[model samples]
Target: MMPMVLDWFIGNETCETIKTKSSDDVCQGDSTCYNVDNGSGYRCKCLDGYQGDPYLPNGCQDIDECKDPNLNKCEKICENTKGNYTCLCPKGYHGDGRTDGTGCVANQSGGSLIIELTVGLGIGITVLIAGSTWSYWAFKKWKLIKLKHKFFRQNGGLMLQQELSRRDSSTETAKIFSSEELETATNNYDESRIIGRGGYGTVYKGTLSDGRTVAIKKSQVVDESQIDQFINEVVVLSQINHRNVVKLLGCCLETEVPLLVYEFITNGTLFEHIHNKNKASSLTFETRLRIAAETAGVLSYLHSSASIPIIHRDVKSTNILLDDSYTAKVSDFGASRLVPLDQAGISTVVQGTLGYLDPEYLQTSQLTEKSDVYSFGVVLLELLTGQKALCFERLEEDRNLAMYFISALKEDRLVQILEKCVVDGAKIEMVEEIGSLARRCLRVKGEERPTMKEVAMELEGLRMMLEHHPWVNNDESRLEETEYLLGEASLKIGSNGGMNNVTYDSITDHIILQVGHGR
Candidate 1:
């Protein structure tokens, strides 16, 4: 394509046959001949220190390597010959003149310290390079340390330390983790480590240095205005030992954003199991009821059992995690508030997932234990109906599942609107019982809604009834007790396990039974 022809022997023959002629076709002085690999003929070349056409006699000329400094590796003098050149050392120097051979060194009677000089130079260079690298990295390390200190101070770390010291060691439950520890565990919060993310924060699956797999929640910016409450989260969770509650291993305040470490739950959220087509179909009504009971038990303990009453401001199916066994673990207390016992509930800036938030709380911003109940009610509806808390695919008026469900109950579409799987897997009576309980929880007024404690008790009673015989001896009153509470003198095991003495009193709140865990 370049319009060029390849040079070859005119006859396209090997050099041996051509050299037999003993003609001028042979290679010139300082040149070598060889047959082309393609058998296109022979070609010639000049040797070292020579360059020229090999077709003519004496055509290859000796290169003046002495005139070309780069061509000669000489320390002092260079002598050009027919094909190459020789190098010589200077008068006061010894050793070969060529640097590759034995570069010139001073010829002294006393041995020269050339080796020592070489070693000294090598060490000096190594130290200089090492020092520069160390300085650069050291500066980076210093900046990180300074930044961590700044963040720790900004997040009230010192105040936390003081508060922790003020209390007895027996109450110490939340550990303070370093930023590096979490970074290593989460591979520096790499994208691959991320398990879930939402408006509040992102949760990453991490493995601690101690080899425990954990869930690391990296939250959004903290409200410096509520630093005290932020720190109190440790106190609130530390005192909670419920198996149904996700355990807070520790927290990290060394970052611009805070990080909370919790025990990792293997199975995903109840939301996924209920809404995901494949998972929801496999879940039986029994499993769903137990999960509901476990979650309610956690909220109940937080409200009525903890030293300080806590209101889970954010409660939904997604916040309810399931373990390998599908047992519920109430998690994500990012929006929870600790209420003083004297106050029934705390007034807060309304914050919660849509479709599940309490309308009362949304209106008045008065978050109470009932607010969580309302949200839990929505989760219960999800279990029964297998629908999202909010979905736009339905009629505009029915987009909110709570409203849709309430309307269905009013029109007596309970049997028709229930998830096919739930209806098929559970007894009709049990299904209706849960449906009625969920309706109670979704009541418009917070006070009218059952407390999380009442919900947990009722759910546990329902579960016990399913697993065993009813407390009454086939009495017609069994249906009556199902509407309010289990029959009188009925000993019921809590969802997580302790036995509670349940009785039908005028008010359910007066029952001071132990709603704790133990089979």
Candidate 2:
């Protein structure tokens, strides 16, 4: 009030004197208030190391002089304080301005006590934080690698190796693939590379760095009950050295679910080609017969030639793969059983594909090599008729093709159900021979079926006979006109309508040179 009265005598018409006095009263810390002298009221100024007018609210700020490149004393490190800056030592270097002494004065050995204390404290804190973080990350990485190794050993890696060694080392073509290699090949087991899925595992197509294509089958989670079965499957399949069998290249046990690597089959499964309309019509009788013969040869090889005879408990058309040349390559030994040669048979629970499964084996809980023979026979029926083993779309009595086929044979009505593709006027004898052979194979008693060796021999004979005389068994003359257009040589049919061999290789040279279309 006294200041205001004094300013009123000095012409305080706009109250500028009172306002300046009020602003000056609030100024603090290296600041002062002054009137603009032009009657614009009052403002405040801060001293060095501060910013803004102190008279206004939140106007003052500490100066960031360290941001200036010229203020940096260290090579790469710089720090700012209230009115001063720091000459901090750079990373991997020590001493406080004693070595270079560029901007800061040198501190002597013992006389540098204060400078050393501050520098040491800062360096020590930084190093401790960095080292703790690095250690934590390194520990985590090491633990992950260790866990993978533990699982590799636990999942019967050593046991599988021992099983593989028991066989003829020279004949086995498969190589042991490492977990890291497979992971890299499949892009760390990426979901996009998956080609097929099954109840037990997912199958992925992988290409190695060396350009080798492979199928990697990764098993689903293994429960306690399935562990032994899984291990047993690995053991049995690893030792099988037959050419017809699907080659088990190796396995990766590092993952939570084990992965099995197999040789890649390019043309896909026989089942796909048979059921698919386009593929079914493309197959010729010769291709189908060859597929049957090769498949039977594989079954026979497993049942008789293996060290411990194997019964492929589940033999279905889907499990049979075809090569680029349409050559049949039997695969999928996951459900195979190793039977001791000395034993007549083994007693096991029923397990197999439903339609192809042997009724005798399923009912008795007694499995034998003939169980696979029955399944093979059912697959043979599929090849003959180009129909599914079980199709509910048909009448109830004709739904199960195997049952329908057997009934047809009993009623002498096989010609009614034969696929148009197979109706190449096959001689009645040859047709009866094949039908009778299939019926014998599907006999209710396992002992009644022919051995795989017999089946293979018979099919091979049929192939040889047909190749020598192409026209003998063909029922359809439309196929004859097609063959004539293709310039295939004609065979002579006797009065009995049976085929006699004639030379056709000269004309067939071109056709044989062509790529095989059926798989």
Candidate 3:
């Protein structure tokens, strides 16, 4: 057994085989502990950072921390005794704590000299503190300048300037704004000046030196590699000029991200009126249809009439701004793609907001004009239902409004799915016509969707019908006139279920029910 234990210790026998050896255990003295085999015995020293052999009686005593100057962080004077130390301020200062200093030396004399010295030292300390704070602020300001310069370069400020220079005569000049000018205009970029914020960046409401109210869009930071894309966007935006599309007034490139200036639309986004809790009740069906038509017209212009066909990758309600009178101003071209006339489509990474993204473009990454059509479909649905493009309250697979709408159509339960706002007896024929238009727009295949021009025409037709046949409060004669103006007086809305859905025909009913319901 001793020979086998020696063999095991010398590695001649395996550890597993030597486990049952009763004489294999070994022990060391009080200060040290050991595990022994014949020749492979080793010992461990007590931990330095800690103390004591873990197995010994009372273990080991802690090292005198005060004895080691390196472990002490005493600011001024450290006097070591045994296991602890005393801290003292230097001769000029007087304090007991390690990091503290009692004012300067306490005055000993009642003389004017002592008073003068105290005043001078107090003033000196105040000045020093103020200077240090100023220096820190100056350092931060300098760092911000350098960081903004780096971002400007990263966002292709140089390329944009070059592009502007090349087309200075033919194109409307693109302004290169300074940070100081923008900061002054926006009152140091105060939150009160913030008009909008979204995936692109925050927008500030600014009154320029020239007294023009403008919407300033600060682009989000981009990686250095995306500088080319940034320059491309600037170039494309500079060329855009449509009455309905938000006008690009200028830009500021001195900031880390480029800041775009646009003509301010005071009424805010179309989404606000259609869905915002404070404003939705004021939006009539006629206004919704008119806004839809105007939006479609702007989109059609972008798709076909722009110098280069621009596919507005994002075409949700939020992107559509409204002037004081609610005239639609299509905006936010951050995700817009300029499709070249020579190319049929662009194969690029999918980019667009989730609810508004084209299913075909999302799946295949082949972006075309029809991708805009799909997004416009969502917008149409929003206008029709006064609900969001995506809602969790809906069924799992039908969570998306487009899918839910299509499902509603398939089941022929259109009136049930539409908001109560639109359900107050819209003519079955009129509702069917609008629903069919929405269905065509929401076609699974892009090619099957109508051209933006056709969509605009259809929406215009809908608008004209609503304008002539305004939903009334009381007079049956006026209702008859509305029917006559619609060009077809035969269409009826309600089923024969005694639940006759009809427009309010009395002034009292109009006041009670509020805004006119059917368009």
Candidate 4:
């Protein structure tokens, strides 16, 4: 259908008839009147560089077309006139400078130099130029090689080599990538390739030559003296092989800051699904529980199962990535630290996100596994309430979700604060159990919080109970059954790991409960 056009005119008669019969017209400065094809007799249009009704007094005002990119097709520099525009190329270039034309091309200064040399000198000039060019490139290549060596030594290349040499397993390794490889993979670090950004560094989405997609992180500049620390950290992180953890495939040390490459996660992040309006609608409570369990399990492995214990100093919903199948993949180890086997905790500068930081750790500067538990607790609250870790929009006391969540729980407002989707899908007791666990995790004292292993087991138990026995009613017998099944899961989770192979007899080996109405 044709769009509605609002045409203006002084009279129903044609422009020729109006002009011949009258001495003046409705058209004003720098405006002209034209016969309207519609029922209106005529319309006034500004000549150029103007907008608004041209029939009114002082309506046809000039506009700078150069101020807007779409208004001009200049390939180089654009200059606006009273009613038009002109394009001009910069120095050392020649062309019409209009995109519709030849645009701009570099002046052939090299040819001019060659011509001058040929006329003054002999044919030997050509050979001299060729030799000079070759030597120049050769010298530049040598300099680049020397610089690469300097960067390698400064970035702890030798230390990494020694650490790798100590490892006997060929399958367990982190590749040392060349700068060229990563640069090409991320198209020379183009802005469009960036997938995520944080205070630590920027992560780029890249495709390798082998058709493998990867997430490449280029870190900020580091102190050269602390090279051994980063190199050792890389070694420890590379040894961590967990399905729910984003694998560290390789790193590049030739640049000012190291570049780390990891397996690309298909789904964006747990935070996105939990908080994004469109995604949050479809994010079920069951999926949130599974993601929470998976994240907890990874943290447990990092703390206990790895060769060296690792404390994820930073943990939040954003760090919990999701795979194509919506499986959780815990990531962003920039703030992670390896805990020595002999020590229960380490003394370090306090570091963590605001709403997720353990209060004890923040005050004492003691890093521990419970710090991760605290952050994970904040993530749980986010999944539960679909709120950010910190929000200024809320009242001052209610700003921090962690404190506010516990406050809500204390006041028995759990149902009121929970995300509608979560409250809609889950039973009250199930939600209460998870909320209690999160409260324990978010205790002010790090020592008061349960170990990551215990937290993982609790979440796993809940998951298993849900899988084994679907809820029927909120009666006393059903609640007892739920409790018994959860207890059963706690005992057998180590062996079954929430797999489908759990048999009824095996799960109920010791616990005896009466069935039906019998005593």
Off by over 4 Å in 4: 1-141, 223-225, 472-519
**Which lDDT tens digits does candidate 1 get at residues 145-247?**
9999999998889877777777787674778899999999999999999999877899999999999999999988678888888888775686577889899
Instruction: Tell me the TM-score of each prediction against the true structure.
Output: 0.67, 0.63, 0.64, 0.68
Please give the RMSD of candidate 1 to the true structure: 18.5
- Clash pairs (backbone) in predicted model 4: none
Q: Which digits, one per residue and each the tens of the lDDT, describe model 2 over residues 1-519?
A: 355422312232334556555654545565655555655545557866778757666567777766876544554456778756666764334555322465344345555566678899899999998999899999998988898877766776666666667757675534556778998999987989987776556889999879989889886765545555566666667667656667887777777777788889998889989999888876777788778877887887777766668888888888898888888878766666778778868987677777899999989989998999899989999988888988898889988778999888878888878877777745565665566668888989989787886676566655655665454545555455534443443333344543332211211122122122111
Name the lDDT value of residue 338 in candidate 1.
Answer: 87
How many steric overlaps are in each model, in order? 3, 7, 7, 0
Superposing all C-alpha atoms, what RMSD in Å does each candidate have to the true structure?
A: 18.5, 17.9, 29.8, 28.0
| Cα deviation of 452, candidate 1, in Å | 1.4
Cα displacement (angstroms), candidate 4, residue 10, comes to 99
All models: lDDT?
A: 0.80, 0.71, 0.71, 0.81
Residue-level error in angstroms, candidate 3, position 125: 7.3
Candidate 3 local lDDT, 1-519, one digit each (tens) = 355422322334433444455454222122333344455544433444335554455454555555576766566667663335567565445455454444234334555567778999999999999999999999999998998787667667888888878885866866878888889889999999998888878899998999999888877754566567657766777677776789877787777677888888989998888888678766666677778777888788878877778888889999999888778899988777778789868987788887888899889999988888888889888877877888898788888999888888888888877755565535456556667777888888888887877677666655554565544242445554554543342334223211112322111212112122222
